[model samples]
Target: MPYLLPPPRAAQPQRLLAPTVTHLARLLLTHAPAIPPLLTAILPSSPSLLTPLLSHLLLSHSPPLPALSLFRRLLELPHFPVPESALPVLLRLLARSRRYAHHSFQLLESLPSTHPHLLSVPALSVIISTALCASAPGASFAAAVSCFESAAAVWARAGRSFGAAELNALLRVFCARGRVAEARALFHRYCDAYPPDTRTFNTLLLGFKEAGHAQALDLFYHDAVLRGFVPDAVSYCVRMDAYCKKGKFLDALQLLDEMRKRENCKPTLQVFTTLIYGAGIVRDAARARRLFDEMEQSGVTPDRGAHNALMGAYVRARDLQSGMALMSEMEQKSFGLDDVTYNTMLCEFQRAGDLEGIWKIYTKMTGSGFMPRTRTTMLLMKVFCENGRPDLGLELWDYLIGKGCVPHRHALDVLVTGLCCRDVVGEAYRCFRELVEMGMAPTERAFRVLEGFLKKKREFGKIDEIRQMMKAIQLEEHQAEEEAA
Candidate 1:
């Protein structure tokens, strides 16, 4: 074989120009009024050079305004033709930052009027999804609706409708956040012009089920069937879960039987797990065990989720023996224990106030090299604090740091609250300081705990300092929210 000329290196111009372009972009951002002749000189030489430079600036987590300002300056250049590809990159960059979410929305809203050719389903979907995720919930919802309506008008002008996927994405976001009412209205608004698909119905069903609106979910499920849409596995799962949620196991079982009879809709692992978890919630360990058996018999291998569900049921029923046996079976089957399994056992032990059992699980958890998550850390810290062991709580904090897991503010709240309750004010103050050193502001709850403790101890100087620090944090956060808005 002819020596495959070592996959061609990056063109020399790109390698050389990238650094200079980045420097100039930074220079322009920092030192505004960058020499226009300089940009005109370099950019005109190779218009292609600007694409990577723009992408780099946008994606480098630089403040959005300065980068957008640079883009504007480049736009004024006569020779440099900024690629349309830059639009998506810029939109993504802005969407990712809470501070620039409002700006991203502005860009999205303007696309229909300013760059209608760039208005497509996927581009709109990205903005919708990103806004829903990256901004405050109330603001995100308003922005999503605005973006969708804007895109819908543009699509209508072109004699077309928004794709089902975009509609489903918006529906999913609404449903996920317990905004089923808004989601339902949105679905109905669009369903007439663009017929709803199976996913649309399933999404609504799941949303209603999750919101604990069983009656509404049941009605919606039947309504979808009435509209000639066949219920899929997800639909059946949602319905079954709704019944299970209400502890109407008889109804849930009936639905399961109906699901088995259906030729197309087979029960998935999630379906079984839902039922098992529901059974556990009702303390029906026998039923949960039988469901686990049925799941395996149905040729669905019991994955970590299935095992965890069964374990949770046992924990709920206080059947530690069965839980332990299942744990052994899990290990034997190579379905090694995960954070959920460990957390479940820890919860059970914590409830029973069995310090020995808690220690055993904690040791095993850390030994397994799976770092405890925020919730787990918080739970353990609370337990230790309640048990008069602030020392152990601090040790857990150190372990978390050693594992490179940045403990969340909620965890700090637990540790601080626990310490204050135990009158370990000194340790609590130290813990609070450590968090501040890590550059994370403690939650207001934690701050209040320290403030009250310091006040009680007559440490007026420290209280004033802490009050000042909290005020500064709140001011910074308020400014960020305003910027985001």
Candidate 2:
């Protein structure tokens, strides 16, 4: 206390030098992670320095660092209560990150439930709209419905304040998850509250198409026209799908012609695929082929799905040569062949008892980097069994099991039937026991196969096994009845 030095000279006020906004903006653009610490240091001493720093950070920098921490700090900064200008930046970040935007959403939830500031921010409205569509709290329909309700409430509060893009995103998410009722409700709400746009009507029409609600389709068409929402290519596609579903092929063709004449909207690959499927259903492969040719002529590259559909049409027509030809073309074009393609060809060759053709396709599939799926392996095994090659069937079976392919009940049934046909009652009984252990019931056909095998071989031991399987079946039925009661 006695060692007092000369009185410290009163601190002189240095000339204040304000940092240029452009300099701050440049720093944010060039270096994002360093700005947060620099801003935090200056923000406490000179509160007014926050606006420019935050504005620059939010606008110029993407995925602002420590977003959650920064938002919490902003809430505590008495001098810089909620930067209203930064809300848009926050919303944009949320939209980009999607499910990863959890931290930002948590900050939003921290605000007062009825915060008036959030009501005024259009960006906040957009974020809420997206969250409703994208976020699934639990993997259940009820949970999804709850999310939709929450989103609807936010949209209601925003009134006519949201934009067309936000509405379209919401409607798409709803339709994708089969929430058609909610989609319709939101669509109606948008139309009643906001300016009607062609995109808005298109979104609603698509929802009806996805839901398979034929009645709502005509109403949407009329309402869209009355609202001066011109139909586009996508609009025509939706109508086409609807007409096809209702078996109104003539109406669908008329709509297609009208679209071509009025809107110059050319058919897409998807449009042709739909037509092919419809033709296949009605057993009109000729029309399907015409459309396929038209699709090729129009410069649209056929995809694997298109090729598969064509192959399916040929198979339905019993034209194996044509189907094989299309598969060859698919291979030349480097379109990836999936299990379905291989399985289809395998089943066809098996039916024709063309083992050489089957092996050729199998080798080709493996050579082209296509791994055989469980169904493919099962189909091949069945072919082996049917052609009296149990040794080959057993080899395929071991390979599938080793690769962790859990054979389905149908596959087991086929194996059992094949064994019984060869008078191998012991093996058939063993297979039936294994299937029962795996919680699959033997079908009546399996029982008949066992009985026929025992009769042919005069084997009472196999008959005893069959009786045991029947008792097990009866026990399971009784348990199910008790549960129902």
Candidate 3:
């Protein structure tokens, strides 16, 4: 009562101004969840305001999950009847956040099929098509395929015909999923029905590459020419990938030149990476390096994949210095190294029998939050054994196991083999026991190595245990053979 007598003016009730769509979009960007009520009130009266707000929400660094709930509520408003218009934006948003894709699919399934908005919005056709292409991990490929089928069926039932853009989206989804036959059939069915565009041919070309049907690609290219569709950048990229796979590097290079001359198509970073990788595989490190430099000079930034391809070229040539130098250059340039790059370098170090170098790299990899994978662990274990550091190998085994980075049976076999080679029979048997406990089936080579060590030491109990494990393994193999028969 005493405090109320002296209440400040700040304590007085203040009127809340209803937020405009623009203001709400800004709030969404700022990640303000408190503005949903204001948003809900304005959405029905001004549906136009919702698009930017929804787009902003979707594009936000940390998007609001509650926006999905708000979107559902907004759909209930009579003025916001065009659900299809919202679909493409929603799909783009879903693609950005995997969690959104999971929730959005559920929301989509809940919507009534008879809703008038389903038929009214043409943009939805594009959304469904894009969603099919950019499917997330939680959403199964089958689910995406089902969604596409449902959308196509819905459009047909509604007597609605899609435009080139929407058809392009559907075609892309089909092509991406490797449904080349289905995509081709749809292309022929819809070719005369709509004006053939660059996108139509691009989809067909991508489908051909995805399916590895090089013959089909030639047919489609010829068909595109007859249909008066000009090949674009995407078309050239698809063809380059196919040509590279077929080891037709000269043909691939020729196509690049033709694309530059006729279509004025500049090869993208991905195109260059594909050629470089293919060249590396064929041990043409010189051409691979040439392409790498050309890619850089052309103002294309080399990504990790490109860098890895160059490293592979160096590795294949057995030029470890050059390979290591490339790794140093990657670090200097602040080009992030992935697990593959680190693993490759580690393998090279192990092969060189440079234990100190391997240990330094191992420390750096672990410190940088790059957990050593099965192959990395096995390589390090082998290095330790060769360097007369069986104790270090045991330490590594324990560390990897503690970190939940348990190796496969093959890796365990390699470690046990390393231990046995060092004549650390007791340590080797201990590791074998741990491997078995970890559910790794010690291979016959691993068992024989451990048994030989135990036999030399006259450890009869350990020998009998090893024999029991061998019998169990043989029994399982026999049972598997019987099942197969």
TM-score ranking from best to worst?
A: 1, 3, 2
Candidate 1: which stretches are off by over 4 Å?
Answer: 1-142, 150-162, 192-194, 417-430, 444-472
**What is the per-residue lDDT of model 2 for residues 51-143, given as tens digits with 9 covering 90 to 100?**
555444343223434343454565566555455555555555455443334444445545544343553334554454445545565443344
Q: Over the stretch 1-485, how does candidate 3's per-residue lDDT look in tens digits? A: 12111111222243345564434654433333344566666667776666666654443322434456567666676556544556556656655543345444455544545453454333454445546555565573455556655755666655667567666766676787788887777777666765667877887898989888988898879887886777777777788888878878788888777876774667788888887877766778899899999987888999888999899878777777888788889988888777688788888776776666677776677566455655677677777665666666776666554333335556667677777777777877887776554434578888887888788889999999878876775685576446534
Q: What is the C-alpha lDDT of each candidate?
A: 0.73, 0.63, 0.67
TM-score of 3: 0.51
Give per-residue CA lDDT, model 1, range 27-84, as digits (tens): 4444433444565577667667666665655533344555566566665565466666
Name the top lDDT candidate: 1
Candidate 3 achieves a global lDDT of 0.67
User: What are the runs in model 2 whose C-alpha is more than 4 Å off?
Assistant: 1-141, 148-182, 189-207, 210-215, 343-360, 372-485
How high is each candidate's TM-score?
0.68, 0.49, 0.51
Tell me which residue pairs clash in candidate 1: none
Off by over 4 Å in 3: 1-216, 224-234, 245-247, 261-266, 279-290, 346-369, 375-395, 436-485
Ranking the candidates on lDDT from highest down gives 1, 3, 2
